[model samples]
Target: MSPPTRRSPRSRPSPEAAEPNGTFDAATRQQIDAVVAALHELYPDADCELAWETPLDLLIATILSAQSTDARVNQVTRDLFSRYRTASDYADADVAELEEEIRSTGFYRQKAKNLIGAGEILRDRFAGEVPRTIDELTEVPGAARKTANVVLGTAYGIPSGFVVDTHVKRLAHRLGLSAETRPEKIESDLMARIPRDEWIFAAHALIWHGRRVCHARRPQCGDCGLADHCPRNGL
Candidate 1:
């Protein structure tokens, strides 16, 4: 018998392809489409806020962004990226020194550890290059699906899945698009309702709305264009 062949890293299937079909009714589908359209009009240039020059930079910045803001992560990475230019640099870095370097980001010990371990994996397994697929990218120590999606979609222009950060999760529920709280479940709900091409932009636009308008403590309903269509669930 022939051994089962592994799929090429570049050919990783989009989340939209694997999601269950017909999750949205005709009315609901129209509502979601309208919501997405409004968001596009409001934030036509929405994109990843984290600054990165390469996939490795994005991966590292994303890992550091856990429980932290993108502004904070970028502040830390300005010095961090300049010091460690490549995955190999991180792989060979002193853990103690690295921890101190990223201390301001909070959870420095774990973040530094993940950075080193991920670097080692990249150097050993993927020839010191960032993997293009969600499956392969998630193999790095700090990268879960959220981080992988950020790197793949933002860095490589591959729409692997919708990025479900805190903003996405909160906005999804508030807009009545997703009843779930967990990021993964919320992402699934969104993928089922939103079109394939809009996945990446949708995440960025939602994130921008959450940050600029639909704030956690005080969502500016009057300032929001979606206020009319939104069910305002849990708000």
Candidate 2:
């Protein structure tokens, strides 16, 4: 009889990795709390990185942020916003020129089209003012919770909820506070776990952590303050 199929030694770790031995112990809970406290104190002034001068600017900047870095969006919008001030300006903008202006942000064609379309909607439907409510904002072209959140929070001083992007999703998963990978699911998990008062800042802290320490790839676990508490599972 043929010898039993030999399994590679490396495969032995798979079971160990998935096993939930001590997923959330008391110590882990304490550490999670402490980590959040540290971040709150460390980044009290945590704000959205996108630069904008007005509510409309913020709306435009956020619209330009899809699949793009905040820094890049800011860079592009610096000049873009000056040239196009109001909804009418964007709505009537020459598509090719608008595309060229935001080319650096990636997906410029789609972004420009969305911007123009959203601008037209704002002009026709809402009198050119960025809406303060979630449902109204989402009705615009290319506006989702992430974009609407920026407008509601930064533009209207309303807590629309957390802005969960790639950074937040990865960081939340690595931090063991959430098992879900999708941004919406992760946002829901975070909202359920965190205090409503901290919703705005929690996203900022997570973003800062994701960018600085808990990166999507090769997170610096050794230096991370929450490393001890981190499950680092499925990461």
Candidate 3:
């Protein structure tokens, strides 16, 4: 036993690495409520920024938004949507042409492939309509839990689960609302803490706050509305 093998600094668990137990006491619940109130006040009009007129439009836009900004996705979809109005249109699209259409979205090849696959599934399995349930939506290509949640909540007004995007993930940790690293686990913590009715609104509000104030690289803590309640965890 060579002097009790010392653990390296890098190997040590981060201060922010505590895992949420998916349950909260009264005090914690109150804090969560306060945070929700703050968010409501901060972003009263918080909603999905992606431009879409139909469930299929939203489903495609959300899928296109992966690793891309909403603004960019919106721009691309403006033209793409006009060209491909239905699932059958996408299912029949040429992969190379589709790739070129969404080339600026980054990972165009894969995105195009997923879009085609999703379109085919929606056309064949779902009768050319976006599925309402998370399980069904996740069956489409490019629609993982996050994307499925977005489609379900925003498109169908069903709070299947919280949409744990990068912004939500960052805000969850910084606000000390969750201590989990994985999005699914973090979503579980959030669902446990936030009210069922407020699930959809909370996800949108957190996203807006994260984009406007709690930025990833340089959070404007001074301008943050939740500054008082925020423990500034892992800052």
Highest TM-score: which candidate? 1
* Candidate 3 lDDT by residue in tens digits, 7-97: 1111211122223323567788788889999988988878888888888888889899999999899889888988998999999999999
Per-residue accuracy of model 1 over 1-235 as CA lDDT, tens digit each = 2211111112334444434334667788778889999999999888888877777888899899998888888888888888887889999999999999889889999999999999999999999999988889988998988999988888888888889988899888888888987777788788877777888888989999999999999889988888877898336
> Model 2: per-residue lDDT, tens digit, 1-235?
2111111111111111212223456675576667678778757777778877778888888888888998888778777877888999999999999999999988989999999998899999999999888878888888888888767776666766677888888877777768987667776666656655666777777788888888777888777766655678325
Question: How well does candidate 2 match the true structure, expressed as C-alpha RMSD?
Answer: 14.8
Off by over 4 Å in 2: 1-32, 233-235
What TM-score does model 3 achieve against the real structure? 0.89
> Candidate 1's C-alpha lDDT?
0.83
What is the alpha-carbon lDDT for the whole of candidate 3? 0.83
- Model 1 regions lying over 4 Å from their true place: 1-23
Taking all chains together, each candidate's TM-score versus the true structure is 0.89, 0.83, 0.89
Error of 2 at 31 (Å): 5.0
Computed on alpha carbons, the lDDT of every model, listed in order, comes to 0.83, 0.75, 0.83
Show the colliding residue pairs in model 3. none
Model 2 clash pairs are none
